[model samples]
Target: MFVKNGNCNFFSQKLTFNTLVVPSQPIIAPVGSDVTLPCQLDPVKDLRDMMVGWVRHDLTPGYIHIRNNHLDFLIDQNSLYLGRTSVSESRLQQGDMSLSLTRVRVSDGGKYSYFKCP
Candidate 1:
């Protein structure tokens, strides 16, 4: 499947009938600028109430952010990401679990992962 994200076309796959698709290439952003990491469900599933999480698996408190209960949960978020990560509820309703990282820094360099509880 193909989904148009921003100015690029991203290829999507429906693995096991449900999957989250993201860009194949890395998103390059200048230091201190905000950037949106594109992510969306291939089958267009609504995730408003889903327990969606973004994390840096290598970190101690891996969690960067989480969304559920109709709000953002930050109690366990990593200190490096506090006040820097967010997800759009409106987009989540449409299955776009993209993470918005604000004020990028050198420490933020690395691969992040995503998961949904259920």
Candidate 2:
């Protein structure tokens, strides 16, 4: 189940997920401001092979790569999010794969999702 925060601006969820899990929480931020989209999980006992990623839901109907920890943004295939997206540096330890968009724009308002696997 997902729990909503006081301001109702963010949501959080937890569970014993299997494989690549998509916890619940679609962060929405106003344009022209900085925002962090958190993607976390209950600690998987053994994390020898875990992959996490943050993606933006394209209005035109598609998933655009925002940022991948090791490879960074897959810019060539994701031109729109090229320079406007970045992942949080604290992700590794904080279990937050949130993406920060500076100088947000109208185009930034949309569903944002994060995925993680073990």
Candidate 3:
């Protein structure tokens, strides 16, 4: 899948697959501000029953957030992000898999990956 100008082009052999969308350029946010890491699934489908995970390779334990069974589960989430990450419920159904990181800190700067699983 490729996204340009808020439009997405999807190509796949399977009926269901995960397609993550990241910005073409790096995202910069001031310390203490909030930032949204953009991601989505192409050929959009309802994700209420799937598992969505966000991770940063630079962080310990990696996991930033995980959603499953229509609920946010944090048992394996990193302590640093225990209460600071979330996905927009209002937009999830529309294929929006973006992560909302609040009260950003300097250490929060890094590459993130979004995962979707059946």
Best by lDDT: 1
Q: What is the C-alpha RMSD of each candidate to the true structure, in Å?
A: 12.1, 13.3, 10.1
Residue 72's lDDT in candidate 3:
97
For each candidate, the alpha-carbon lDDT, in order, equals: 0.90, 0.54, 0.84
User: Please, what are the lDDT tens digits per residue for candidate 1 over residues 1-118?
Assistant: 9899899999998655787899999888988999998899988977888899899988889999999857999999999998999999999889899999999998888889998874
Candidates 1 and 2 compared: the better one by lDDT is 1
**Top-TM-score structure, candidate number:** 1
Clashing pairs in 2: 32-104
Tens digit of lDDT per residue, candidate 3, span 1-118?
4345546665545464556667899899999999998887786777777888899888788999999978998898999897999987767888888999999998888888888888
Order of models, best TM-score first: 1, 3, 2
Q: How accurate is candidate 2 locally (lDDT)?
A: 0.54
Report the poorest 10 consecutive residues by lDDT, candidate 1.
12-21
**Compared with the true structure, what per-residue lDDT tens digits does model 2 show for residues 9-102?**
6655555744333436655667778766544444533322345565555644344443343555454434555566666555555555555666
Instruction: Using lDDT as the measure, name the better of candidate 1 and candidate 3.
Output: 1
lDDT (C-alpha) at residue 58 in model 2: 61
